[model samples]
Every structure is written in C-alpha cells, then in structure tokens.
Target: MEHAGKHALVTGGGSGIGKGIALALAHAGAEVTITGRRADTLATAAALHPRLNALEMDVTDEASVREGIAAAAALRGPVRICVANAGIAEGGPFAQTTLADWRHMMATNLDGAFLTFQAALATLGDDDAARMIVVSSIAGVRGLKNAIPYTVTKHGVIGLIRGLSEEYMRRPITFNALCPGYVDTAIVRGQLPGLMRRFDVDEQGAIDIIAKGNRHRRLLQVDETTGAAMWLCSDAARSVNGQTIEISGGQV
Candidate 1:
C-alpha cells in the first residue's frame, strides 16, 4: 500500500504496458483511473481490479484530455501520479512515410503526452507531491531504422520531460520518462507480419529479429516495465526526477 489513498491516472491503460502498470498501481492501493479511446477496452481493464476505474479519453484531442481528466479527478481526487502512456506504433521507411503518417504519429505520441501532463498537473494543489511519467521508447535516446516518424515523436516526449523537470524543480512534483526496448506488446506483435514479409522469413525468425534489438536479445515482459513504474511512484524515488530509466536489459 505504498500509494494508499492517492489517485493515479494512466492513459492507454486499456491494454499492454499501460494496463500492466494500472493494475500494479491499484495493487499498491492507489485509486487508479485507466483511460483510452475504447470504452469496452477500458471497461475490461477496470474490471480486473477493485480499485481500477475506466475513463474513455482521446489524448490527441485537447478538449477530450482536459474534460476526461477533470471527470477523473472529480471521481477520485487530484491525480498524484500521471502516466502518459497512450501512443501508437507504426513504422515504415522514411521515404515512404506520408505527411499524414508523420502528423498522426506526432499527435498521438508527442502531443498526447503534452496534453495529458498539462491536464493532470492542473488538478494538483500547490503542495501536492506528484509524479509525471512518459512512456517513451528506446528510439527516443537513439535513432531507429525505418521508423523516422516514430523515432521523432519518442524523442519529442523526452524533450517534454527534460524541460518540465527543470521548470517544476521548485515544486513538489517530478517528471521522468521510461525508455524500454522491444517489449512483447500487441504493437510489437503486430509488426511481425510486416517483418516476415519484408525479410521473407518465418514468424519465429521475425520475432528473433525484433528481439535482437534488445541488449539481452530477448523480448521483455510487461512486469519488467510495471516494476520500474511502481518503483518510480514510490517515496524512495522522490529525488529521482528529470531522468529516463532505460529498461533495455543493458545499455542501449
């Protein structure tokens, strides 16, 4: 019960890494509000824990984010832990990427985090201790091949945290990011078919190719990322701000 009585809001908590972290926060005694664009998906995740609640929110839209977070705060309390985890992962060669594709990536990955953090922060009082986290990809720290738009959005969120951390240093809030490499999420699984077709390899071969991107040469589990999130929300990590915790099993 490390997070007893606090309200933690996790965007994209309907599935994958977001769901995992929401459940963990609920287990730690926080009133967890999981938000996403899908009402059914959010309901399914909310049903997993007694402390978990569902909120349908579209992060890409400024109005949706502001209203949804306000509703969440009214239901529970001011958000003490804000996890901006809602994002899409679509990758293609830089030359083939259309302008719409780049715009969509920026809207969802970079702008979504910006809207979420801003809305959540607005709910907190001057003295309330809060933690704002962005779920970035390893591509944020380094370039990713054939994923120009995705890499740029991920890097943009890192810049968001770095800037917010400095600006809010005098306050009781902290801003940080998580950079994980090749986690076994639905997004990663969806890319396998493309990899198989492009490389003319079997499904397993494509999986192996993806896993090779990680330093450990294996796919990371949801719990690995959840554990890091739990630690960052704890009292021990109060001073650990403006940093990106890389969960790639080793150096990127």
Candidate 2:
C-alpha cells in the first residue's frame, strides 16, 4: 500500500490510460476520485474499484472544476496526488484547422490541466508530499504532421508542468509529465476509421500508420503508461520533478 492514506484525483478516469492509473492507485490504498464529463462512465469505472469514487467534472469549465474538486477533497481528505489525464486527440493540417478546433484542443488538453492543478493545489498542505502528473503526448516533444492543434496543446501542457515545478521548487510537491506514444486505447480505436478514410487505406494499413508512431511499431498497452505514473507518484521519485518521461519504445 504505497499510497495508503493518500487521496488521489484522476481526471478523465472513465476509461483508457486514466482508468488504468485510477485502478493502480486504488490498489495501492489511496482513496481515488475519478472525474469525467460522463457521469455514467465515471460511475461504471468507480464501480470497478472499491476504493474509487466518482465525480462529475467538466475540466474545460473553471467553475465546474473548482466545485467538483472541492467536494471531492471534502469527502476523501486533501488531494496529495493528481493526474491530469483528460484530453482530446484530433488532427488536421495547420491551414485546415479552424479557430474552434484550436480552442477545443486548448480548452480540454491544456486549460483542463491548468484548472485541475489549481483546484488540487488548494487542498494540499504545506508539509505534505504531493505529485502532479500531466498526461502529455510524444507530440509535445516533436511536431506531428497534420496534427498542429494537438501538438500545440501538448506542448502547452509540458510547459505548464515545467513552470509549476519551478514555482514550487522549495515545496514538497513534484510536477511532471508523461509523454506516451500511440497507446492501445479507445481514442486510438476511434481514429482508425478516420485514418482509413483520409488515406484511402484498409483497416490494417490504418493500424500500421499509427503503430509506426512508436519505434517498435506496435501499440503500447495502457498498463505501460500506468506503471510510469505509479513510479512518479511513489515516495522514491521525490527528486524527479519537472521531467517528461517518454514511453515511445525508444528515444524520440
């Protein structure tokens, strides 16, 4: 029970990488609050773990995030660990990307993490140890062709973590980011059809196109990312702040 007595909050915990992290935290004895826009999905995910609780939160809205996180902290004690894993993955050429598209990506991927971290920091005690992990993507490190909006949003998230890490350098809180490449998640599955349509390719070709993003040419399992999150949240990682741990099978 490495996380015993710790109250952990995971945004976008309804499915995929967030769900994996939530389950791992619960198993480690933390009182976990799983947040998502979909109440039904949150409830279903919470049901899977006895220590996990569900909260309805729209990370894109400041008011909702402030209220929802406050309520969760009241119920589960101060939040010592927070995972900002909620994001949308949409891709298009920079010229073809609309203003609305850029705003949507920023609101969910970048703004969401900002709101979540702010609310979570309010609950942390001065002497208590804490971890804030932002789920960024490999796109944050390098630009992805035809994914200008996503790349920009991810880069923003990494910047948020780095700035926060420096601001809290003297404090016990550690801020870091995880940059994973093409994880086998529902989000990737949703992109397959779009990939096929855009490239005029079959299903295998569509899959291959994404798999090639990783050096090993295979989709990473959700557990791989979860393991990295768990390590960062552990007491042993006290000195590992302001770093981006990439899970792209090799150096990016």
Instruction: Please give each candidate's TM-score.
Output: 0.98, 0.97
Q: Compose the digit string of candidate 2's lDDT tens values, residues 1-252.
A: 999999999999999999999999999999999999998999999999899999999999999999999999998899999999999998877898899999999999999999999999999888878999999999999999999989998999999999999999999999999999999999998889988999999988998999999999999999999999999999899999999999999999
Query: By lDDT, who's the top model here?
Result: 2
For TM-score, the strongest prediction is 1
Error of 2 at 193 (Å): 1.8
**Candidate 1 clashing pairs?**
none
Clashes of each: 0, 0
User: How much lDDT does candidate 1 score?
Assistant: 0.95
Q: Please give the CA lDDT of all the candidate structures.
A: 0.95, 0.95
